[model samples]
Target chain A: MSRIKAVDILAGGFVVLIGVLAIVESTSFDMGTSRRIGPGYFPFYVGVLMVLLGLVIAVENLWTRTASDFGWSLPPMRSPFLILAAVAAFAVMIERFGMFPSIFVAVFLGSLADTNTSIWQKLTISVAVPAVCVAIFKYGLSLNVDVIRWRP
Target chain B: MSDFASNLALGFSVAFSWQAMWYCFVGVTLGTFIGVLPGIGALAAIALLLPLTFGMEPAHALIMLAGIYYGSNYGGSTASILLNLPGTPSSAVTCIEGYPMSQQGRAGVALFMTAIASFIGSICGMLIMAIFSPPIAALAFSFSAPEFFSLMVLGMVAASTLASGSPIKGLAMIGLGLILGMVGRDLYSGLLRFSYGVDQLYEGLPLVAVALGIFGLPEVIKNAGQITGRTVEARSISFASMWPTRDDWRRSWGAMFRGTGLGSFFGALPGTGGLLASFMSYATERRVAKDPSRFGKGAIEGIAGPEAANNAAVQTAFIPTLTLGIPGDIVMAIMLGALTIHGIQPGVSVINNHPDLFWGLLVSFLFGNLMLLILNIPLIGLWVRILAIPYWVLYPFIIAFICIGVYSVSNSVVDLYVLMFFGVLGILMNILRFEPAPLVLGLILGPMLEENLRRSLTLYRGSYTVFLTRPISALFIGIAVLILAWTIYGMFRARARRRAALAAGGE
Candidate 1:
């Protein structure tokens, strides 16, 4: 079997795409002279180096083994999905509902990432965490965030 | 000697204040609690606490933050000794001997000795920092744009190459970080570079958000439900149980001093830090042992050397950050960002501009180490119980804290989105086997490097040879080149050997 792993291809392709994006974007910015180089100059050069390095990573993986054998599949997404959703939920809610509700929803969604927890445990945590947080951040620290404003 | 005495007096005066002492106590206590937990690390803990320090005086804020950094080192060995898990990355070396010692039913002695060694290491490292920083700061005054640029290059190269993982991947991550660093308004041209209509990003990528997203969230994502470490046996570590035998005492002192020496040297380097020092100390101890077989089998020197080494490295790691404004690692980089957020510019001028701040931090280390020594020895039982706090209970609080902390940075919701973006990016990078340390370093150093490069080119009329013509700049670039060559050569040799092995196996 070929030693090349899915990780190397994904990583290399993504990096090269970033390099191309950088190089293409620099075209809109002014590329001044070497003595008075513009914003584009540094990134453009960095993009070139990135492309070279990315190519090395992609090609080098073809005949050599990676540190771990991840095989040919995407990584599992259970934790990443739940955890990211938790953060996203907070971002959407924080300004509208303020700190307490936002933290409440965020903690609830985050607690779901660990499937080992019972429903009661999650509920208790969802309630208790926000209370403590409100007490600490809003009451004690006097952070600018609101606890339960209904601005929306 | 008198000058040193007076400076220390100034330090004590600042540190001995009620407010400073209170914050310092809070920081170390919080630091120990965070460090004793498995699946979290000192880097994430520091980032989590950074926002809370925003309202304080810069000196008090830094004193607390520095307390967290070193106090965590003292608490880090707890998990390594009691369970086989390393609570912090630098303490991973402690696992080699520490776990074995615990298995042999000598857990208390191991804990006690580590506290003693860590105390010695920290005190010695602080002294070294006091003696060396002024001279280094003075020397840095002579540096210009080219020298700074070359030194940054050297730092970047060393950081990406010497750190574990594929050197190519590490370099690629740095490239990505440099691009990320350019995501705001161009300072000289007054034009936005890569913000893409995000108004909040005009200043730059929020350092706290990116740091949390990259280092903090990724750790949570990877280890969320899986960190049920080995159940620690209830080791009742009373004062009598904690005492080392006379033979144990004999073997440890020499190793502690030697490890302190190695750690002090490595910690002052711009890119390496406690992790490398601890590992190198472990290797040195094994090499010098009368019977090398005793290592990894509860050899007292094994624990003594590395615990001392990592703690010492923690103290000296501040030297480069506080003096030259170059971080020894990601944690130091965050500390630098803290100073910047507090309106204190970090550079050679830092020491001269703010002696009270510098000396106050030094004296606080003295107090913080003593605090850790107290907390780690007599209070060993309390931490053992703390280690039992399951991962499910812990990570949700971490998520809440990360969100709140990032929001508190500017009271802006946009940073929350930035947190989400980097959180996803960090996960992808992890799956790709890319190390995040070098990228963070690159992000931190990117602006300074680009600015210096532009200035040097403009000053020397675009003569590329100016980097080579300047003596110190040339030396820095030369070291960078040598490191690059050595890494490439090492990779090739490893590849060739692997190929030969495959051929011999009739593959």
Candidate 2:
């Protein structure tokens, strides 16, 4: 027996979830006559079509037999986890803490993902990156953000 | 011909202006900068730099962005030759011959020939774009709502089908994109569709944020620690060694022209771009070579042909994008988003309404290619040195820029969250083998597609038959149907063959 491809199953299920959400949400909007397409008309049809497409993807994965098919495997979570945390840190801190602090922390977090670098190297990078960025984005380009502020 | 001359005169007038020329220079320089860096691509660079153009003139903005797009093609081959790494996807073909050529100590010759080929190809492609675009736009003027809807359908179907993944998944991504496009408030009724209680999304997902989130962040995440300091060792590429022999010139000139011809054709076609064009040119060169055995083992024609083809394709890819408002790939899709940010509706009217922007951009290609030729030859060492920059140091700056870039798009912190959300989504989609290019194309085209669909329905009094009844529209639909059927048929046939092989193995 062939092992099921988890990638296709997950992709199909994820798509189905999105389709159902679209269909469910679109039902709230007006479904007018075809002559005058309501907001939902385009989306509602798109949703139904998506649902069918999702099902096809899921079913096709089970029927097809091929070792050449791109097998699903978990990506190296270290980089993704650290990098995402960095972006999240930036998002959460950018408003409340301000630009410099937000960027410093984010860069610090992002820099930690590199095992090749030492703590001293990471800290220097975290500091230098934000300084150069402030010069470029903040000073050079005049990006409208405070270098430091206490919003909270 | 008079119209062509006068239009070109107008183009020169706009492009020669010092400020416009300055933006163009900066653009190509930066484009080459990131293009030489192994892991970072033109797409991510464009996204990262896109926000900086917000304060500029629309014409200059487009000129800069366009410069980045083509300049990267020139820079991409450097890494391919020196290292086995490709700076851009289209330049991957270069590595096959380029790395071998470098190994054989003919790296300088390969580099020089590629620059010369790229320059010729770009010039020819630009000329073709200049000559062909007006007529194409003129043809597009006759296209109405049904025709537009059909064309968009054709474009979406064609783009997804041709994209690197399962056609169904591509279609599904497009569907997701369409839903994302419907997030903003409805134009007619003013009803919000999928804002999902987040009031910030009423203006639609910020294009810059969405683009940067999808293309920019994932690339950084994937490459941050993974590809560490790649240094160019003691071998320095001096200008003295770059000159080619008489035989080299004779072999390469024909290959360059042939590659340009193939690239211009493939590039102008919807959904396809430089990657496909360059590969085609490589195959053509191999087929037409006197001794095909020379191909994989440091063939001058290999580098010359593909480099020419990719650069030529880069120039012609703008033809469909600027004329049809339907971008062919992820890069073009970002470019289309750039125009939308500047309040320019890309279509047939773009040429008629914004002649200066269109013509000036076309003219800038000449200057940009010239800039690339200079950068590639005399300044080749600078780029080689650039390869030595450590990834750990580079990626933090990249992450910082991404965050600030997304934030500065509208000064909304909410956009930051949006960026984070899509960054994760991008990673997830990457795992599922979903090609983000189709999704992006679908997202950008979604609103226009919906608008055209509604208008066609209204104009034909709710008659869906109008799509088929109209000749041009019907033709487009027919093409879309044919492509979809062909793709599905191909998939089934492959599956059947796989089954047969499995049965044989069992026996």
DockQ of predicted candidate 1: 0.73
What are the candidates' individual DockQ scores?
0.73, 0.79
What's the true lDDT of residue B69 in model 1?
85
Stretches of candidate 1 exceeding 4 Å from the true structure: A1-4, A62-74
Candidate 1 interface RMSD, angstroms, 1 decimal: 1.2
Tens digit of per-residue lDDT, candidate 2, span B1-507: 999999999999999999988999999988888877777788878877788888898999999988888888888898899888998889999999999988888889988988888899899999999999999899999999999899889888988887667889999999999888888788989988899899889888888788777888888888877886576775788888888888889889889999999889878777778888899999999999999999899888998998888888888888888888877566888898888888898877788899999999999998888888899899888888887777777888888888888888788889988888898999999887787877777788889999999999999899999999999999999999999999978888988887888799996
User: Stretches of candidate 2 above 4 Å error?
Assistant: A1-4, A62-71, B503-506
Worst 10 residues of 2 chain A by lDDT: A63-72
- Compose the digit string of candidate 1's lDDT tens values, residues B351-396: 8898899999999999999899889989989999898887888888
Clashing pairs in 2: none
